[model samples]
Target: MKFKTSLIALSIAAAITPSLVTAEESDIEVITVTSSRMDKPVSAIPNTVTIIDREQLEQQFRTTKDLSTIIGNLAPSFSPSRQKMSNTGETLRGRPPLIMIDGVPQSNPLRSGGRSGQTIDPAMIERIEIIHGANAMHGLGAQGGIINYITKKATGDNEHQVSFDVTMPNNLESDGISFGTSYSFSGESDQLDMIGSVSYRNNGVYYDANDQMIGVDTTQGESMDSQSADFFIKLGHNFDESRLELMVNHYNMENNGDYMAVTGDKENDIPTGAIKQEQPWEAANNQVTTTSLTYTHEDIAGQQLHLQFFNQNFEAVYGGGCWSDFYDPSMEGNDQVTVCGTGDNGESLYYEQSRNKSVKWGMKASMIANNIAESGINLAYGIDMFRDTTEQDMVVSGASWVPESTYENIAPFAQLDYDLIENLTLSGGVRYEYAKLKVNDYKTMYGYGDKEIQGGSPDFNETLFNIGASYQINPSIRLYTSFNQGFGMPDIGRVLRDGDSFPDENPSIDDSLALTPIVTDNIEFGADYQGEYFTAKIAFYRSSTDYGSRMVEKEDGSGSFVVKREKSVIDGLESNITAYIGDYDDVGVNIAIQNGEYDSNDDQSVDTDLDGANISPNRINLFWTHNFDNDISTRVQANFFMDKNFKDASDEVYSSFDGYTTVDASVAIPVYSGTLSVGIQNLLNEDYYTYYSQTVGKDTRYFKGMGRTATIGFTMPF
Candidate 1:
């Protein structure tokens, strides 16, 4: 399956590239409000873009188990599950991408576990805009790409709407269940109009044909649940022939889940008394809460102002008898170690509770103006400021081991977009950021050392810039090129610990080390066309960097224990085509392909050429949608991912996961002036894995995706 997926990806790329060269122009124009903070047509922009409408989102969510699956199916090889299964972490175009809600940044690089950004209820989303390639105009740190989530706003009509859903499966009838409902009310009696919505969702773990737990542990009988609420209010007044408006929005989410991990071995009177490294169990719990508020005004002097604030709290705890409070030096290397004179997997013998906290705040304001009275030129500028702080502490009941340390960053930037020629657009932007870090005074574990290690305030100041231009070859086609810079600073927790190296019996030397920032220079070229029958886009990018992040190996050179800095380069290509086949029926099809690779890497240090390396090389997404009549319609989609290569040189072993394709079909039927949807996902009952990783000398699996799911939902209009 993996090999076939890869081949199909290559074939799709080969086909889309040529189609881009021959794409023609279309007359339909869709207005966008993100790039310029004002309404503008997509064709007027200088970049490749993809928009996911509300209908598409509803169709996917109704059939899939979670949003993670939606992301993986749409973009080949892009998996959120990879964060837990793979140690190296997942990146787009060889680097971490940026995520934004409305116009606010949600990425906190200093947060533990690297889980940034908040999840939104799909029913509240109006549309999603995806911008491929480096985003210099959006400010620094956007090396790979950007995703902007634009949610639904308020309406003035005095009406309410609600939606609800329930799911079914091809196999286990008792194990599958899900339901959510949303309500919206609007009125126009006073100067203010408002809309409020609340949603709740819950789902049990899914099992595959093999009767395996998939990603969950049957021992825990775990499940996931989430609750969200959103509200928007718009107040406006008419003065003479002009009007002024004010818009405010607020969103909140609370989620909780249990996580599963593989422990070594479990046996009565186990040697080392520490469970063997291959036993699987559900031992951790995660809870997160996020809140955001925004205020904005539009149509004011070709200028707009936006202010946003966000706060998120996350907590993770190891549960059960496995999480005890005790440290016995005698348990170092012995199999039959004692924890308070009793045998308990290293927990009671040597364990400590860990907790992490993070806070982030940022705001941006931008303006756009045209030289209507000057040289017929257009200009755009914006300034932004952001700050983030994090702290982690290890606690055992009432006692503390690792002290709490904090890291913070302050950044401010400005950008300009100008029309240098009649048919060309030029842009330049720069950001200067300063980071401050401090480690609170603390004592070493086990009284191993007396003197506390104080992290000297390490500060970093960086300047990032980019230049780009777009040329209008004609009304049907446009060419664009850009050169930009990207950077990422060393994280707070890893900044102090250098991993195991240089000694086993040193009490005076500080084990923590400070690292430097990694930067990259990226160049890109792309073209877009809107023809009579089809719309196509193709882009190529190259990234060269002096410093890169990779896993570091121990002295024995058998495995990895640390993340080291290296130098490398990456290049890739992306292309897609959308065709309108019929006018009477309004039928259309869309296809996309993406390829990427690392030109140079230092995986040999960890004993593998493929470790810490993954490129889609090829991906194919196909969608067919038709409007059968005014009130009814149907759609079908197929997503395929190529097989990826995983090799560990030290172990002298190579493994590859076969790729598979997922087929989805859906239909909308109008009942009593309401919309009813029915859909089937994974229609072929194809069992495929989304991630693969090694644990304790053997390979383990997280999920096999979903076999087959059927959903029925209804949206009512009062």
Candidate 2:
């Protein structure tokens, strides 16, 4: 009864439920030792951790295949889904997180493509691990935390599945119809194991509650009116004292909609819309391929050894623009006509688009040693090295927007765990990072006057530390605290490409504002209680930095995004609890509340509150899952976003956002030969603007969330 808080039960909503961390076993033990950076029980780790296992993933899959939606509902701190391919406004802990796939980094930190969250399909994933807080354990770009998607593993028994799914809005319009199919297999023979999967999905056009066409996000890319495919393969072999594994994955998505955006009037509350029309440029697209090889050896001179090598290749093309000073030439069935928006033959409105391409390669090695000479102590150490080359260019104009930049980094880290008392463990770790970025001279595109900027080589050296202690109060409860530091670099590409920012007097990257490396310090206190019929976890955290980059819209009215570095602080509380209602039913509630502000004018005072693009709104969620006779199961979830207002304490722009609530439900039944599934998203058909569109207050980007939707799926195991 350590978690008896009856007074708050009336306001209870569930972000953590049976759909999130459902363990078949009742004993509290190590869930998984893969993504913690160290092999230990979560109770021994001093930081708050969130683990989503396959059962949870499967439950979400029955509703929708959107990765962001699945994560947003499972984790309280995650931002609401933009319902798009680009993760522009998706921030974790009011900051960007380093996303990885089975130990391979997928985030393009050098350039902001905003496609890191969609690198892999959920069908190929077995579980997800999220380490909440600022830390350098992953070596770079983990300002908020680390999210690792662990791939499925091959079991001793050979098994396979084939599935087909379809989703659409409640109206059942043809344009709202979407479909997908996938096949996966796991096989093992003696010491060899293998797993493979291929999946494809074509998303239909989206619609709001009013049955109006949702505006397309041509600038950052969109999930509506798009088609995507994913393929993955993994192989492993076990030897007497060593093991080896290889993994490869390829994914691509492209929009082929013949439509144009219709800007709206936010003041009058007219949401953005879309119409059928010929587009001026190539459709937006994204493609990614990753490869990794890993080796492990046990009892290597009394230490466990592990090594990994990985490579990632990525490319994306954005939608064409129709703004002033941008030349428009590629109109379908028309010559290179520049007449765009009130311009005649003589007056040309310059319209252009860009593409992002990057390649990353890296290697990591770590070793673990325990109880040296029979002492009650343990240690783990590792080293990581990586190099990335990235560039952006106008797809049609053949002009470089951002010069090719190569980043090289090498970091070594070590962690020690010591038992200070019978029930208390002290842990400490430190990492040193050495990085160099080399950029060549390049010219900015139209709008900034096509200015030529000189590029220089910038290098950084940083030492980061993390220390924590966990004390077990009893068999069912534990308390912990931690202090950690994280190192991050803003995408210099944004600064280099901004022709308007470079003055006529200066032309070098060395003196560029907002180009400094960001180092954040974070502290947290947490407690966890695990019982047979009740479970609860809660954490309070605060992070601050004298200088750090925050994402913001460009003030030049180009409808582009940029980064601003200033003093900022963020503090929040996250908690979750689950109570078994009976033998086959469970109900739960969870809440996420955070506040963030920054020194907008660089005066060193955090006076202005952060916008929705940087921080998620406070949320309360309720969820319940029940099992019935004949192995049938059902789940229902409801999430509410609390309204918020920003106080103008500084010179930055301010706006208020109204909140809304949405519900989702799903059920599974055993059919003749397979499982039949059905789900309803936004079951109440609530109509509302997204957090970003409401808070940013830009007419062109003001958009509404999705309306009610229904999906059906069937799974056949062979």
Please write out the lDDT profile of model 1 over residues 297-320, one tens digit for every residue: 544665554545555545443322
Over 24-118, each residue of candidate 2 has an lDDT whose tens digit, in order, gives: 33434546546666667666779878888887788889888988888788886888888888887787778888899988998887887788887
TM-scores for candidates 1 onward, in order? 0.78, 0.95
**Model 1 local distance difference test score:** 0.51
Candidate-wise lDDT, in order: 0.51, 0.82
| Model 2 misplacement above 4 A | 1-3, 6-26, 325-347, 504-506, 650-653
lDDT of 2: 0.82
How much is the lDDT of residue 240 in candidate 2? 92
Pick by lDDT: which candidate is best?
A: 2
lDDT of residue 604 for candidate 2: 92
